[model samples]
Target: MPSASTRPVAIKIDDATRDRVKRLAEARHRTPHWLMRQAIEEYVDREEKREAFRQDTLKAWNEYQETGLHGTADEVEAWLASWGTDDESPAPEWHK
Candidate 1:
């Protein structure tokens, strides 16, 4: 969703860490820098999910206050846990 910017980055990592990253890159048929970028992208995605969930929870509480009803985090978790569909069953042993 944003324009891409490219620039060279330099860092000094411990020998062991550098070696491990090089080996991982070889195994994946990519350069160590590419693997590093991939790791950074995954980290950013996880952080975004955590922040969004927190904001959503706060919004839900505000709506609840307007309705003069309140629900605890545990209560919401329990309600979500109870929701399931019979047709969405796990695969049978034979399928495995």
Candidate 2:
């Protein structure tokens, strides 16, 4: 048997929105409840991604503040050149 924790809640929607959801659900062969759940999940996932990016940026900024990149253009160029990335091949990919 299913748990009561998964029980649906009743809510009111405008006619226009309800019609749109019905059409979309019909097209996708899914219930309106499922579509709404998927939409909420996607929204939460995108928000999480944005929050993670913001946190990473703040952390990097703090690190840069501690160890300033106070080098001349020539020095920066020399360091980059020392990494053996000449005009031959493309740079490495950094996919997660």
Candidate 3:
């Protein structure tokens, strides 16, 4: 029996895609249902992260516009260039 968190979903795919999914599932020693579930999970995870990033960017943009506070392009570039090094600098102070 499936858990409460699991629900049956019906999706329609073309013949070629359905065959591909079946072949891939067989190659991985998994059922077609498992493969589809894994694919949906992976896709949802990626899209959720992207959506979060987009929302954060929009929030930051709105805040910047409201405060007219931002770092110069050169400062931002230098900070980015220092990434992954001991010399990595902190974010520059926001300015008008």
Candidate 4:
């Protein structure tokens, strides 16, 4: 029985997908419902991160257009390469 925090969800899938999910669930020693829940959780997590990244990129683009200040690819690469090293430094200066 579902607990108070849980609600039942019904999803329709093609036969092939249903079979695949069953097989995967068996292999992982989990019920189909658990597998589906895990898949949905992972997918939502990944997509949310992707959406956040897209939003950040759009904001950066708008800022660049408004200020005409940006970093060159080479400078950006150098800064990225410095990550996790003793020489790690702040972002390169923005240029027109």
Question: Candidate 3: misplaced stretches above 4 Å?
Answer: 1-4, 83-88
By TM-score, highest first, what's the ranking?
4, 3, 2, 1
Q: Which ten residues in a row have the lowest lDDT in candidate 4?
A: 1-10
User: In model 1, where do residues sit more than 4 Å from their true spots?
Assistant: 65-67, 70-96
Among these predictions, the greatest TM-score belongs to 4
lDDT of 2 by residue, 6-54 (tens): 8567878899999999999999999998888888778988999999999
TM-score-better candidate, 2 vs 4: 4
- Which of the numbered candidates is closest to the native, going by highest lDDT? 4
The Cα local distance difference test for each model comes to 0.76, 0.75, 0.91, 0.92
Which residue segments of model 2 deviate by more than 4 Å? 1-12, 70-96
Ten residues in a row with the worst lDDT in model 1? Answer: 87-96
Scored against the true structure, residue 95 in model 2 reaches a CA lDDT of 25
- Candidate no. 2 TM-score: 0.59
* lDDT, candidate 1, 8-76, per-residue tens: 778888999999999999999999999988887788989999999999999977876677565556665
- Compose the digit string of candidate 3's lDDT tens values, residues 3-94: 57966779999999999999999999999999998888889889999999999999999999899999999999999999999999998887
For model 2, state the Cα shift of residue 24 in Å: 0.3
